[model samples]
Target: MTNNDIFKKLRVALKLRDDDIVKILSLVDFRISKSELGAFFRKEDHPKYMECGDQILRNFLNGLVIHLRGPRPEKTNNKPQKKSNN
Candidate 1:
């Protein structure tokens, strides 16, 4: 299936509205206008239909991950590095 198809399916499965998608994408620092986002969901034959790019899909997935699972905790470095002799 095309990226558009996958995107459309995910939108339906998640029951995400245009605003929700905008927020989800923002989580990953990806900014997309509602009009642009709407283009992705348009019918293929429509004049305004825009093909979904890999970058957009990838960022959406990353954002979705953060949406479903909270942000990853910061790593703690308990071991100190040893000093090297010159």
Candidate 2:
């Protein structure tokens, strides 16, 4: 239900280690240290436990998409080329 819970589940389901996650996040230009990432998976009672924020989750999801499907192709101009008198 909580963001942290969702993050934890996804981490397990994806079989992603901390290093893999860091690389995945980089795909979207989201920078995160392994220690900070670990904090999100810690028990709530732990002093270093940090709640996962929506921005982090959203970025991770976006990066994951790129990781699985590769980055989207660059957009191309749709207009017809103008004729030139050679």
Candidate 3:
């Protein structure tokens, strides 16, 4: 499933309304219009505003994850590090 699909699914699983999502977003100081919010719910692609910045999108995802998955975890880089010893 797409990321947006996962988000929407989480929204339903959490019993959160679109207005609820919009409200939570506003509570975190991210201003988004109801029409734009509606488009996000209906979108088959990532919302443009979300893709525009890491902080905003991260905050949004963090909120949703908190609602569905519970507290946020620290992000980790799983990539293997290159070793250089000369």
Best by TM-score: 1
Which sequence of candidate numbers ranks them by lDDT, best first? 1, 2, 3
lDDT of 1 by residue, 11-57 (tens): 99999999999999999999999999999999999999999999999
Q: Give per-residue lDDT, candidate 3, residue 6.
A: 62
Badly placed stretches (over 4 Å) of model 1 are 80-86
Clashes of each: 0, 0, 0
Per-residue lDDT of candidate 3, residues 1-86 (tens digit): 55556656767887887787776776556787776666546644544533224554566776665655665688999999999999
Clash pairs, model 1 backbone: none
Off by over 4 Å in 3: 43-57, 64-86
C-alpha lDDT (0 to 100) for residue 23 of candidate 3: 64
Candidate 1 lDDT (Cα, whole model)? Answer: 0.97
The pairs that clash in candidate 3 are none
| Segments in model 2 whose C-alpha atoms lie over 4 Å from true places | 79-86
Q: What is candidate 2's lDDT per residue for 46-72, written digit by digit as tens?
A: 999999999999999999999999999
